[model samples]
Target: MEFEEVLNNLKLEKENNLAQECLNEIQNRQVLFHSGFEQEKKELTSLYRLRLKTAMDLNRDKFEEDVLANWKKTIDELESCSAKKLKLNWVRTEFKQFMIFWNSETKKLEGIFYLYPKNTIKDQEEYNTGIINGGLTVGSKKYNKGTFIKEWK
Candidate 1:
C-alpha cells in the first residue's frame, strides 16, 4: 500500500480508539468522586496526555519517513525510465520534466535550486551564482546574517 494510505489508516485507528476510550470513561464515570480519585485522575490524565503527544510525534516522524522513501522510489523509477534517453552524459528532457513534476508536488526545491539548462556555459554559471545569491538573500531576510550558520553548526 502507499505511504499516505498507511498514514491515513494509522490516524483513523488512533482517532477511533481515542473516541471509544472517551465514551467508555464517560459511561463508567471513571473520574467520579472517591477518596484520592482526583489525584489518580490527574496522574492518569497526565499519562494520557504524554502518550498522546508521543503518538503524535511518532506519526509525524513516520509520515516524513514515508515521504522520503516514496520520493526516493519515484526518483529511482524515473532514472530507470530515462536511462535510454540520456544525452551527452546529462539527463534528458523527459528526466527534466519528471524532476519538475516531482519538485512541484513536493515543493522540495522551492527557494533552493533552479535546475533548468541555459543556452550557454556563461548563462549556466550566472544561473548557479544567482541561485546562491538568492539563497543568501532569503536566509538574511529570515534570520540574522550568522544566526543560521551558528544554529545549524
Candidate 2:
C-alpha cells in the first residue's frame, strides 16, 4: 500500500500499544539503514583516496594488501551478524553504528551502490511497480517524479 495508507492503517492499530511500538521500531530501523548507507559512502570515498595516495607515494602491494585484508574481516563480521535476528532494544541502541560499519566495509569491496541499488533508475522502476501492485497508488501519475512537467515553471 501507499506510504500514507500504510501509516493510516498503522494508526488504526494504536489501540494495541505493542503493535505501535513494533511499527515504530521498524521505521527506526529503516532510518538507521539510510544513515548507515550515507556514512558508508563517505568512508569509502576517503578510503579510496587514501589507498590511491599510498600506492602512488609509498608501497603499492603492501598498502593494497593491508586494505584488502581489513575489508575481508569486515565482510565476515557483517555476514555473521546478518545471519541472526537482532533484538529491538539492541537495534535501537546499536543499529545505526553497526549498519554504518557494515555498509562502509561492504562498499570497500563491492562498491556502495552494490548494497543499496535503490538510487538506480532500474531499481526505482521496480520499486514503483511493486508499490503500485500493492495498491499503494492508483497510477504512475500519483507517484512518478517526472510527472512534474514544469522546468522551474
Candidate 3:
C-alpha cells in the first residue's frame, strides 16, 4: 500500500504518529540498505546474498505455509513481487525499547526484536556489558488510567 494509505489506516490507532515514523524508518532503511546494526554479525554483501539464496533450503515449504496463515496480504505481495514484511509500531517502556519487524518469509510477525547485554549473564559480570549500560534512551509510549497517553523518553 501507499504511504498515505498506510498512514490513513494508522490514524485510527492510538499511536498513529509513531507508527508512521516507524514505517518511514523501515522503508528508508530498505531503500538505503545501510548496515543497520553496527554490532550485528559482520558480513560481506556477497556472503549475505549467498546466505539468503540458501536461507530457505531447509524450510521453504513450511515457511510459506506459516506465512500464509498469519498474513495472507503479505504473501500476496511476495507472490506479486517478492517477500514483504510488516508489524506493529515501536513502543518504549521504562527500561527497554520494543520494535518488531515481520519478514515475508516468516509466517507470523512476532518476536521481541532484541533485549540483551551482548554478553551472557556470566560474561556480563566479567565484561562491561556494552549493550545494557546505556544512558541515551529514545522512543515513547502512552498509558493513562486504562486510556492512552503519550510520553517521550
Candidate 4:
C-alpha cells in the first residue's frame, strides 16, 4: 500500500502522527536527493533507515519525546545542508553520551554509553572496562549491546 494510505488507516492511533512524520521526512530527503544535495542526502538516508526501527518502540508505547526531538533536530540540521551538523549515531544526555546503531542480526536499535576520559592514562584504564553491563537505556527501553564493534569502540 501507498504511504499515505498507511497513514490514513492509522488515523485513530498515535502511530498516525509518527507515520506522517516519517513520510514527511522521506519526502524531504527525496527532494534533497533530486536537488543534487548528495552529502546531505546520504546522511539523511542513513537516519531515515535508522528511523524504521522506531515503529516497534512506538507500538509498545515506550517511545520517548526527548529522543524524538533529538532525531527531529538532527533531521532539520541535515536537511538544511549546513556546516553546523551534529554527529551521526550519537546521543548525548546530561549524564552520559551514547553511540547508537541498528543491530542487523537482532533487528533492534542499540545504544552503548561511553565516556571519553580527560587524559590518556584514564582513557587507557577506562578502555579496559568499556562496554558496561546491563546494556544501555534509550528512551524507556533497554537494548543489548550493538554488534557493530568498530563503530562503538
In terms of lDDT, the best-performing candidate is 2
Q: Per-candidate RMSD vs. true structure? A: 25.9, 15.7, 12.7, 18.3
lDDT for 77 in candidate 3 is 32
Per-residue C-alpha lDDT of model 3 across residues 1-153, encoded as one tens digit per residue: 223333344344444343444344333321111112211112322333353345356545544443333233322332343224333333332222333333324323222222212333234222322333464433322332223333223
Task: Please identify which of the two predictions, 2 or 4, would achieve the higher TM-score against the true structure.
Answer: 4
lDDT of 1 by residue, 1-153 (tens): 122222232233344442233223223321111111112323433443464355446654533443344434433444433222211111112111011111223222111011222244334335445766676421111112112111110
Error of model 3, residue 125, in angstroms: 32
Q: Model 3 Cα displacement at 110 (Å)?
A: 3.7
lDDT of 1 at 134: 70
lDDT of 4 by residue, 3-120 (tens): 2332233232344343334334333321110111112344544655366356335532543555555555544434454332222233222222333222223322222222222344
Predicted structure 1, TM vs. truth? 0.17
TM-scores vs. true structure, each candidate: 0.17, 0.19, 0.24, 0.27
For model 4, the superposed segments whose C-alpha errors exceed 4 Å read: 1-45, 52-60, 82-94, 98-153
Ranking by lDDT: 2, 4, 3, 1
On TM-score, who's better, 3 or 4? 4
Return the TM-score for candidate 2, rounded to 2 decimals. 0.19
Sort the predicted structures by TM-score, highest score first: 4, 3, 2, 1
Error of 3 at 75 (Å): 19
lDDT of 2 by residue, 1-153 (tens): 223333344455666443354346445433111212233333444554475466546855444454445434444444444222211111111221111232222222121111212244344446666776787742321212112211100
For model 2, what is the alpha-carbon lDDT of residue 111?
18
- Superposed Cα deviation of residue 77, candidate 3 (Å): 19
Residue 41 Cα positional deviation in candidate 1, in Å, after optimal superposition: 61
lDDT of 3: 0.32
